[model samples]
Target chain A: MTNRRKFLRNLLSVTVALGLSKKLFPNLIAFDDYFDDDEFIIRNGWVLLKSDLDSTNDY
Target chain B: MIIDLDTATKNVKTADYDVCICGAGAAGITLAVYLARAGKKVALLEAGGFEYSDQSYDCYKGKNTGMEYWGLDTCRLRYLGGTTNHWSGRCKPLDEVDFMERDFFELPGWPIQKSDLANYEAEAKSVVDISGDFTAADISNWTSGKFIPDRYAISAPTRFGDKYRAEIEVSGNISLFINANLIDVRLNKELSSVTELVVMDYGKKRFTFTGKNIVIALGAIENARMLLNCDTQLKGGIGNQSDFVGRCFMEHYNINYGFFSGNPKYWKNMKKGLSLYTDSQFSLEHKIGNGNVSMSISPDPPTGGGRSKELRKYIRNNVCKWDEITELSRKFVDFQCPGDGILGTLMEQSPNKNSRVSLDKETDSFGLRRVNLSWQMNELDKRTIRTIGIELAKEFARQDYGRVQLASYILDENAKIPVGYHCHSIGTTRMSKSPEYGVVDKDCKVFGIDNLYIGGSSVFSTGGGTNPTFTIVELALRLAKHLS
Candidate 1:
């Protein structure tokens, strides 16, 4: 299968599997990918649209 | 002369309304237009004042740009039109994969379809002035299109402050309240139905806005923070029984470091594209993923005279036409941001429970507790990046665009990723059909909080590879129909 087809197949299996289990998708858990590498740069660097609450006053 | 939540709720005029909207943004405005035109009594509450200030865009310049954000410590603002006043205006709809329930990652799709949103597409189109039905634009001369064999699309970057500001204020049925911030939700013990919403203005910080039904159109971060902060009523927080109130946060992961060969007509058009900065779109099909990878092009280093000159050594020698020569550089230019170009790139990040907002006892200047975000994305997020980067690079060579200089995923271990808002932060107070996984139901109502509804990008389940404003408007209209 093309990688695209494989991905589609994977998506279908998830639906079928989840449907078979019929259990709810697991809810969100806290996330923190503080890796020091750049491979996952996009993942770790997403700032909220207006993320100022976390800023400090010391500056 | 001071009115608190208790005093106002008790003594204020209790009026009935068909629908009450919140957040005055793309979603809120669409809901107001739909409901009020239908003769429904609708009140839209926004925290920021209207867009008539001299300092409106003065905040986006430099260090001050950080202050214009939403949080007290951040630079975004709180206002009638929400953060969109400063939004770069890139707009795209979530793709079908964004609606799929993918198992490869923690993200899940909504129990909805792209077709379900078909009715509102026209409305979204007319609002943004998108002329045609086809979202993708044609791009054939570019080398990237040679192998990828796909076209680019003309995306609409709707400036809400300019576009819908007057329409919302002038609408007879839509009562838009400026300087109104939703602080809390009052409800009975059953926790399913909410009674009254607690609000605050700038001075007193305690203003009461009562409604038969309430919609929280506050942006994503604030949406979760508002619900989580309303801890007085619910034990785990309103509609937060699963403790998912502030979890599953997602944003488009965007980074584009590539070179361009400067073609003047193409260069001029590319320069024009860059000047708008926040309003272009691209697609990257990830062979390994359920959702195809798409990119919103943002303003990168302009691909004019010198920048392309520096890249001539890397440029491919085969020249077809002089026009294609200048234009193809911006095409190969790695403006590979993951969102519409108005604000910046936003790539869909699969949800990770670790990426979340946790409340601290420390309050904002408004007495709201600070919500700390511990955002994270995993290797799956990189799977498409490497594939797309190589594929796009190959396209550059195939079309003889250049030896395209796209960035390598590998870099210094200590390198910090370039980050910016796509004007699309979603998934904090996610939408689910059931309470087990989300804060809001399919109709965008808080699962257990009866009178409370959420209308914003925050209700998105899986952050798709598109600009979110168009989808935000579509989803808000869908939620409104669920009520009337």
Candidate 2:
């Protein structure tokens, strides 16, 4: 996987793995480079899955 | 009485005094007030007039080729009040750990201890117009091992000009000269003591003032420029013996590390550590670094309208719903916090030899070489910030306060480090026990020059993360007593 994608996957995994850790996402999205991206948007506790993905949530 | 050098008819003249102080800023004024009260004659030479003039401030303009910084002329004010005219008034004493020599930092120790300056600090609080009470109730056990109880006191940030103008006018012993810019320090043939201070005002009118003793109370950058420019008797500068005059420039590397929020109970525990006069502080036991790092948290909930208000209320009111918590987290997900608080870090840097101020060929209108400041950070600095941040993040998670998201820039080695000088310039003329290690000796006197001494943050051996004004006043008060 690409570095950006790999980074996003790891970030999402860490966010979930830590049981909705609040600090991680705030700091991650604080960066202007990733602030505009919509893939991480969450609605009703479910993250909007990024495109170009298979059914399984595996990197 | 305040004499305007610009208007004085007897411009080309010589005067004698017991003490000659350069730079009518915090240190100079503090020392003058104390010494004058003790019935000593003092000659206080201020470069600028009572108010700031463009021509006077232009002298501070310089070049910066090292780290990004505020223009040299911008950070410090060059008037009667000095930089205190624009000070933020945050006050905190240096921790005990800051005065000790740590193996992790180079030249990381002071010749004196906190106790040595304790009495002076008590007096300094009155000078800075802050409440003397600096006590804090520890709540570290609330998070078990997550935080240490650290606190800070606020200052009125006494402006020396407005606050002491009446006292200076009434003091019969102090000859306050406005616009009397110090141009040269003529030493005796042996170069042992400063014999005269050659000052010039606008219109090229010159005046000579001699004193039994001389104290350079100019701020860090100007102090180095003045010393480096005094190359008539000495090759490099006065007190440049051992080549330590302008080395080891230090400043607090302040940055927004990350943001985090705690549950209502967690917030309550944290709130107990903060007050109007004193605010939150943290320290780590068994730390690997030489300097103690202090971090402060600000509650920056969303602004604008009822949406932000509702969002905050929902996050504070609903703790159990995973969906609401995720939505609450998303608000702050992209640098925009829709949450309870924000976290910032103000870290101390180990003294680095390469970080220094040097003379450039470029001269200001006064023909004095402008100071070229080289501000560089070391690996220890980066490592300390990252390590402390990660440790804090882990502790919060373990204690269920909330997760900490460190700024991506802090984690990225190649990311352009954000640039913002806290206006706390320090350590150019660092103090030490011997000449080999520093520019000034134990009593704040220059190494080889007998009667020449230094006052201000320039004499700091280590630039602790705490704001420097409080310590500057404390040291100035101490130096006044020593001189008397």
Candidate 3:
């Protein structure tokens, strides 16, 4: 029962990550490719890119 | 020198002036200063005193028949400084395309070009207390070709009554008359020129002053009311030969049409109070009127204890672990975030003859008929608002800069568009090249009457998307130069 639960948990995490990637970046192809380039990072289950975190002080 | 017509000696009536300007508003005050500097004797008549009085303000009371609107007495002030006392002081020149004749519009374009008024930019800025340059560079990184950054110069809102009172009081050429209401406009025997203006005081004391030239500088609504009320000589009124006097009333249509969720970087970089205007090319291509969009940042609102129903249901059905639920809550909180900004729109109302001011049977203390305003909007005006929303939404999505969720009313064709006015009354006695189309000529002179002229937003040929006060001062300066 413990092993089965671990497998299910991993499957759910991957499914949620893929769903979020598709919704946030529709133009992007393949979640692994974007992850490899470190274009997007998941924090608290929300996708946060470098551009989003950078401060835009110039007005 | 300043003279209180109510207490002034009767001999003051015998004085004839070079110019008799009605209504001591921005236009009238500017005209008086410039014309006096040119060494012309002037009589500047203000219906109200230096300050507000209920008796004087009561003259502005009227009826509104079409569309929801603020009361006539509420929309405008009747005192010496005029509406400038309560103006926002946002100044921007009319766009060049606003002066061009678009084939799609029903009305004729302005007879004068934007260049004609460009010469008075400095003087206008001085009169309104706008310092530094009037132009601002576009956003360096904005890639959207459909929208461009528009700048507005905030003025100190120089109140004409307060700022220029001392100047007019001490000037030898300008005779500032307080509490002098224009009651009649007597014409020459040939009915080709204005001979004299009959003014009345609060106590119904009447006085007449004759001038070589006469100008009605009352605000748009009152200007029309005065013209339509002076029907003693002509059946319709003075300068109403074309029957276009009091027609085509316009106001800036202001409303909130959508909400924007901008990308964090661009949204944070946007200057507070920034305004985006539809590109002139976009307007021409879309066959729509000019529009201005402004965004205000707002805090995001949370619903259902900070988690959406969908997220709560997903977590419950998935039987997610404690750590997973915490992460999902934070993600869902960000995902269902409220709009980052509320998009407000201000657009020009296309000129329509039915949107007008006419005289009502009800009479004021002076025994003159009151005004009955019927403000209307057409399909083009409605379409302009909807198109701005749709186009902005599309552009924001395409550029990946933001997302726009339009108001349901804008998407529905049959839904009534909730609109409000900017209190910028314009275009009752429009300027046209020919008398058949409009009441005033390019020089702002009444077509058949050589000496009668008008100075105010009432003479606007096309009410552009920007505020009208700056243009009013510019036109007054031009008229002063012409008269001098």
Highest lDDT: which candidate? 3
RMSD of each: 17.0, 9.1, 9.8
A24-59, model 2: which lDDT tens digit per residue? 444333333432454333222122233313344221
Model 2 misplaced stretches (Cα beyond 4 Å): A1-59, B11-14, B137-146, B268-335, B412-416
Candidate 1 or 3, higher DockQ?
A: 3
Q: What fraction of the true interface contacts does model 3 reproduce?
A: 0.00
Candidate 3 regions off by >4 Å?
A1-59, B269-271, B299-339
Candidate-wise lDDT, in order: 0.56, 0.73, 0.81
- Considering only the true interface residues, what is the Cα RMSD of candidate 3 after superposition? 10.7
Tens-digit lDDT track of model 3 for B1-484: 9888888877785357999999999899999999999999999999999888888989999999988888999888887888888888889989899999977776897999999999998999999999887654455677788988877788887888898998898999999899999998998899899988999888888899899999999899999899899888888988888888999999999876645667777676565634788888998898888988886565433336543666655644443335444333433342323434567777988888889999999999999999999999999888888788767766665566665655545656676888888999999999999988788999999889989999999999888778899999999999999999
Clashing pairs in 3: none
Reference-based TM-score of each model:
0.68, 0.80, 0.82
- Per residue, candidate 2 scores C-alpha lDDT tens digits across B1-484 of 8888888988533477888999988899999988898888898888998787998988898888788887888899888878888888877888787787776676657999989999887789899888757655454444443345456677776888889889999899888888888888999988998888988887678888998999998899899889999997899999897787778888877766555545455465454333211112233243434222333343344345654666555554554246445545554542333343466456677778888989999887767898899998887777766666555655554554544555555656666566456878899899999888899987999999989999899999987767898899999999889888
Point out the worst 10-residue segment of candidate 1 chain B by lDDT.
Answer: B59-68
Better of 1 and 2 by DockQ: 2
Candidate 2 at residue B361, lDDT? 97
Worst 10 residues of 2 chain B by lDDT: B273-282
Residue-by-residue lDDT tens digits, candidate 1, A1-59: 89999999999986786454323311111112322433221211221112222434111
